[model samples]
Target chain A: MIYELLEKHKADFFVMYASSKDPNFYYAVSMKLPDPAFYAIGEDGTEILVVHEMERRRAERESRVKEIVSLSDVGFYEKVKELGVEKALAETYAEILKEHRARKILVPKEFPSFLYKQLSEHFEIEIVSNPFSKLRSVKKSWEIKEIKKASEIALNALKFFLEIVKKERRVEELRRKVELFVYEKGALAEDTIITSGKRSADPHFVGEGIIEKHVIFDIFPKIRDSGYYSDFTRTVIIEKDEEIAEMLKACVEAKNEAIKIIKEGVEAKEIHDKVCDVLESYGYKTIRQKAKEGFIHSTGHGVGLEVHEEPKIFNSEEKLKSGMVFTVEPGLYYEKVGGVRVEDLILVKKNGCEVLTKFSDYVEVIP
Target chain B: MIYELLEKHKADFFVMYASSKDPNFYYAVSMKLPDPAFYAIGEDGTEILVVHEMERRRAERESRVKEIVSLSDVGFYEKVKELGVEKALAETYAEILKEHRARKILVPKEFPSFLYKQLSEHFEIEIVSNPFSKLRSVKKSWEIKEIKKASEIALNALKFFLEIVKKERRVEELRRKVELFVYEKGALAEDTIITSGKRSADPHFVGEGIIEKHVIFDIFPKIRDSGYYSDFTRTVIIEKDEEIAEMLKACVEAKNEAIKIIKEGVEAKEIHDKVCDVLESYGYKTIRQKAKEGFIHSTGHGVGLEVHEEPKIFNSEEKLKSGMVFTVEPGLYYEKVGGVRVEDLILVKKNGCEVLTKFSDYVEVIP
Candidate 1:
């Protein structure tokens, strides 16, 4: 894979300067580093890692790369004395690459600007797309297991949400309760949107106050420190008002239509188009045709190390492949009727998709 | 302040392309943003906030910026149809600058590289240091209140740590219990380190198993969603071991020695030098002299929106000022004796420093 990326980019080596916060860098090195480190893959697929002396021991123990080098190995302190911290750091990076005899290095588009400004003087650098994103879009077996675990935690949170909606009538308190419950289950529910009534129509509003009609509970909880995320949304209709009954029906139809066509070799955008067609067929407007109301947002996005990642299921022309996972949700939002959405996580397979979500799409709530 | 920064940089306009995750951006806007937005200040001190149509309403309501504009207002749809989304976005940003007749623009060093690549075609951009970090280094009265509140919460967590260590009697479980207690107080304790015995010599190890003679508890909890953080470290002695008693004394002496010199008009590096001097006087080597065994870290650092920020208390010459908040921590580690650290939150005033930490340095556990 590393050789293929180097060949595709026409690079002598792929140099990634990033921290653990960067999902691509984390995916590449298979470890989380709080500080910046250099990870390089040579044309011959020889992987090298460069780190500070302080992190050298941990890198040797935990990093997947076999040939881990420390800055001290390259005379960092002497260089710091000669050139100062900023210049010495940049010079040391250059020295590492020079020792490898790398000429044309490829860096991700998201490379640190400061490094680019400093390193561009020594070598010809090509700013290319992050090779890891496409690679990470298709999940590994272990990664899928983690996602499935997160999904289970999320489904439990959904059940907890339903249970708490009655006792904890206030939306703010109910949100806190659901988040605490998720944390106790070894997952973190950050920014879990629990919105209701007219405010729910805004889509991103984290609402407050007593429960109202057409409440949207969108929960995307990540398993603690694993980077795998679970996303699920369900609009609970309390007291089944006639105003939003048709909107719910249309959303469910659109969601089902999108899911029906997902399989290996199918274009991802076709799913979004089908959702749009289904929603438009119900006499509702869509943003695809430049209309502001109705289905205003994109159909879905790939969910992985980052919450919204590659193979975006909107206007993408990328073919669906096995091991790709994403969300398929369709919603109808109106200021008066509020917002109604039904979402589920789907894993692409050979013939069809395995719906990772276990929760049912039941709408009516007695409370 | 804006005018002073503009004059200092000699730039026609100040532009910040950032998301809420950037503390500098959050400081400038006085609000949190989930997505990237454009913030510009003209020479006339006109603050313009540019956001997507979906966020325009919220920005107008919540953002401190007076002139809030939506992308749609700048004909984003028409440009997207003609030039595509990426180019249109860049063009619109340039369009705003052209409208202000901006000749030179100053952006923070951490500006998005991809945006820089696209926008450089239109304007001459100067990558200056983040002006907001210097401004944030000197805390406001309200900001000091938030930090003080976070400090109180951290001190309470320290007491809870004592309670849990006796009941739990295990390193890993105690770490989790302390973190959970902090979370219950509406703060997040992430990557907390509670280590014992020789393993504590590693300094950053999060250890497991029953407690040993010398155990280090370093708790840094952040107030949830507020972006304020509190850092406190205490090394507890089980049954008053004679091995690490001298080490603890040296650490406390070094910490107090650093704090003694902290006040307005003092160079931050002098405090670090004083700390190193105290430790060396006790015959302990420091990192400044290239020694790895004893004092191997910086004396302290500024604390505010980011846990570590400007006015670095290291080998630097930045002068201290009134209203600046920071930490005074000194630590010593040896393989046989284990590690000991004493850290406290501090606020610099005109004449002296305020010890924001209320917890005692008493190390005896009696367990």
Candidate 2:
């Protein structure tokens, strides 16, 4: 990736550009790029890629790269007839990095601080911290097989939203039919939350229009041509009263006791202090007593190519390694039994983690 | 719009923030905030908003902010137990702009330059150029009724991709059934292009798989609860020989002679030089002679809540202002009948434009 940050910083190139505001330029040019093209890599590994001759034949059939040049292959319209399409796109990106003779570059920390203020006036930059979001927070083996095919299409769009929530009752048409059943199983939903009651205690409510009595689906998607992401959350409880059935059995036993203390080296704040010590030994109140109600947020995160990334189980100390991939999700809000999450998607391993949202944890909806 | 940039930069609080990399923070607190909350406006206009105590009960029911507050109202867990969670979120966003006593804060140019280098160590920031995307480049009458309800659902998903391209010849299953018919007609599609032949001369090709004899269909989207946006390109020429039927009648008379001189004050480079004077009086070659291919890109832009924004009908001098709204598409590429754009969606009026993508341009379907 960016030739291992241009041969680990003895930089002679690495560049990259907005690829629609850096998803580390599509994890370094896998390309679905919507303009602002550039790219680079070099330090002997050479890759190149530029763009904008009306996106040179779609970045030579969607990038693989080893020189895919353009800006009318240098002299971009003779520097846009003397420096104008905004200094002829930074002098044709400095004539395509002085035809690969580029010297000292690198970049990443979400580059484009206005094209790093116009190529830091011609060269020697640096930046860093976007090693494809710490190598997309671990996962490999085909990025965990495209996040296990986006967690099996977000567990078949949350079991097709419990069979269209007993013939649907709104919440934005059951989150547009679980985002068209995760775009007919090929993946690409976004903010797909069904949210209900007290707007499912607002964990970023995406709800609207009816469908109450405790809902919260939170599907999360991505796979469309391997952008790889997946997060799943459950909570349906249509008739489990006993105070949201013991707040969804303490959110499925605080997400199976913080996924039985994760794996490889643990301590993502000890699985968010073991889901805040089993939702504070079932008496609730969390954020370790900063308490904004009950078990307020955090008990999960780190999913691939950004469905929220990096270790973050919360109050982190980092550690947990072995091919990461996250989401433990032990929730339990309550403007009186509203949000009772349970999420899954695991993996970690080298001694413990795997789940990948096999589903079913607090869905009681048989009405 | 940030209270008219806090009474035209008299600035004393114009704030705003990341709401998913600022769509002008959902045009300033109309809210769908996916973190990086804070918002402001004041200088007597007072709006506030804040966030992150697990998003203060979903920004108090999706913001119309008079004040929503919450990094635990103020102390933020005693500044995250004394400046820890990344300097306790910049000391609880400086105690939520020192409870609105801010001092010259403005912002915008997509703010988050690492939270303006840590809120520029306390206020007096200023940035500008994002007055809700230049007041979302003019379209407001409920943002032109949510871009005419996303231009009547991208002209019924480009006439349902000409009846599913007479039996879906793949190209990702006709862009997943035209993004599940623009999500069962309520809007929220993305990069929906069906591209065909010679990858439709690469106007950012989104093509792949079977479909041939030319196709483009670029139906853009948006509406889901008025996040506005709507663009619609049509290029289906399945069988229209005679030099691709005279390059689709010179890209439909260069988008009808650039919408017969759009109204208000004209000059968006005179509708991209009258669609390059009817595609160089039909001999094509554009980028106004920078060529590289016939009629390459831009004869349209500006579209509400970003489907590309700001009066950019190409070589810009910016005018055409009557509550703007744009896209007049006029393309004409060639690899022997490869790209023939003809989009619509106009608006501009004062004595002229309207056509919010009424359909039927160069579609020619009967193979």
Candidate 3:
């Protein structure tokens, strides 16, 4: 995939530091290293990893790449002892690029400004908007399997959370139980939202206080072994009110409506529009009608390496293909009545979409 | 602090997206928002946050700043509808800067290159290596309190881990137990290293396999509410071998030696050299002597909002000041005998240093 990308751009090298939080670095190297080490794919599709002396052995052992060079090989520590870390890194990287005969370097759009300034002084640096993003949007069989495992772990954690929510009073306690459950299963459940009542109206609010009538439980866990993630949201009702029940019903319906339109070669915007149309028909205002209220956010987004990646199922013109995996979430929020969101992972199939999250969205914990 | 920085640099504005992972964005706003929204500090010290319409209410509620504007207020959504997200964001940001009359912008050195290109076309851009790093380095009273709390939580978690390690047979199981214990206490223990035997030789290796003669356990947990981190490392011996015991003693001694010299106005490099001198005297090669083996990494680093922050206590010339909290870690590794590391958080005082981690470094688990 990277070879095709480099060839198409006619670039001499696609250089990136594994240190940068850009997912492309991991995508190219297919390994996770602690420190940000240098990684590049040469014009002839030769992959190289330049790491510190301490990381050399591990890089050689763990990374899929064939050639792993130590920083000392490029005189990094000696240069650092003389010129300091920043200048030494810049010089060492420049030397390595020169060794590869790299004249045109294609870097991620989020490339570090300091490094860009240093590299641009020696090479024609082109800012590419994550050359691997398109490839990452379409999940491979292994990637799908990882996501499935992550989703299963999240569902189990959710089940544990629901069990606790029935007994636990505080939102913080419930959140802790969910997080610990996920961690025990070798996954991370960070930013798990367990908001109640009016606070649930805010999409990004990681909730607090006592568990109330309308509770939002959004669990997104990253699988430890594979760096893939699964996001699932379900607004549970404890002591349900009619208004809250109506909102929850509409949210689930809208989410299903969006999922129904998922297939190969489907326009992302069409799915979003389907969600908005369903919610609006149910007498809910959307971001399309008003800027600040009702169904405010996008229907969903592609989820893989990052929680939110490319091929956003918003008002996008991009068409979805068969291998693409994303989320089909539709939500409605009322400032007075709180919010209800139903989200599930969707894998685009040749004819239809597979809802990867097996747990039912309409969870009502009647305590 | 941001106002002072902008005035000192004589920059019209310091613009950044909340989306950027730079901690300065959160430091500037004093709020945590999920999405990357527009944020700027004007020449007149007017702190402004331009967020998505949905996030506007919460931003207003949560952020410490006075002025919080929605994207719609700047006609961002309409522009996005007309143009697209990328072009519209550029135009919206350009207009926002123009409204502030910002002709000169000082961005963080790690600023996104793609954004730099867009902003540079309109303004005089200067890349500043973390404008707030120096300020963040000096821990405030509240910040110190937060760090203290995080360290306490980590100590408790470490105690829990030690109890489990005494019982558990596998490194993976012990790591999972430690991680779950920390998460249950409202802190994240990601990448908690628990490597055994030769695998412990690699500092960054998050270890695996069964209980062995020597094991390295490095736990760094971020406090959930405060976002402060505490790092602690302790190499334990399952069955005490003479070589492993000697190495552990030397590591603990080296760590204490570095900590003993930590006071206000002490050069960071002197502390690093002290660790090196102690370790070298114990017949171990340092990074200064050889790039790869023995004590290869830096002695320690600053612990605050980020795990590894400024005031790196290494071959650094920067002097430590009162109220600066950091780590004093010294370790020695051999390919054949595995590694031994002893780390503890230190708070620089007017007279000396306060070791924040209360747990004893010496541990011998008999199976």
Best by lDDT: 3
Model 2: per-residue Cα lDDT over A53-112, one tens digit each: 887776777677857888776767677656656567766787677767886786664453
**Which candidate order results from sorting by TM-score in descending order?**
1, 3, 2
What tens digits encode model 2's per-residue C-alpha lDDT throughout B1-367? 5566677777787665565545667777876776566777777777777777877776776688867878776777677656665467766776677766787686654454445556678876766666667777886687898899888988888777788788768888788778877877777787687887876777877778898776777878998766777888877778656766788788888888889889999889888898888889877789877787888777888877778777778876868888898888887777655777878889988999898888667566775
Give me the TM-scores for chain A across all models, comma-separated: 0.95, 0.37, 0.94
TM-score of 1: 0.94
- Candidate 1 regions with alpha-carbon error over 4 angstroms: A77-84, B75-85, B335-337
> Each model's fnat?
0.25, 0.43, 0.73
Give the alpha carbon lDDT tens digit for every residue of A1-367 in model 1: 6578788777788888877778888888877676678898889777888876656666777789999988777877778767876678778888888888888888776676666767788878877778789899899999999999999988988888888787677887888889888887877788788888876776667777888876788998888758789898988877777767888788888888888889999998899999999989989988677666678777888888877787788866789999998999888777676777889999999898899986778655785
- The list of candidate 3 runs beyond 4 A from truth reads A18-22, A81-84, A157-162, A239-242, B1-4, B18-21, B81-83
Alpha-carbon DockQ of candidate 3? 0.67
DockQ, per-model, please? Answer: 0.48, 0.17, 0.67
Q: Lowest-scoring 10 consecutive residues by lDDT in candidate 3 chain B?
A: B15-24
**What fraction of the true interface contacts does model 1 reproduce?**
0.25
> Candidate 3 at residue B285, lDDT?
86
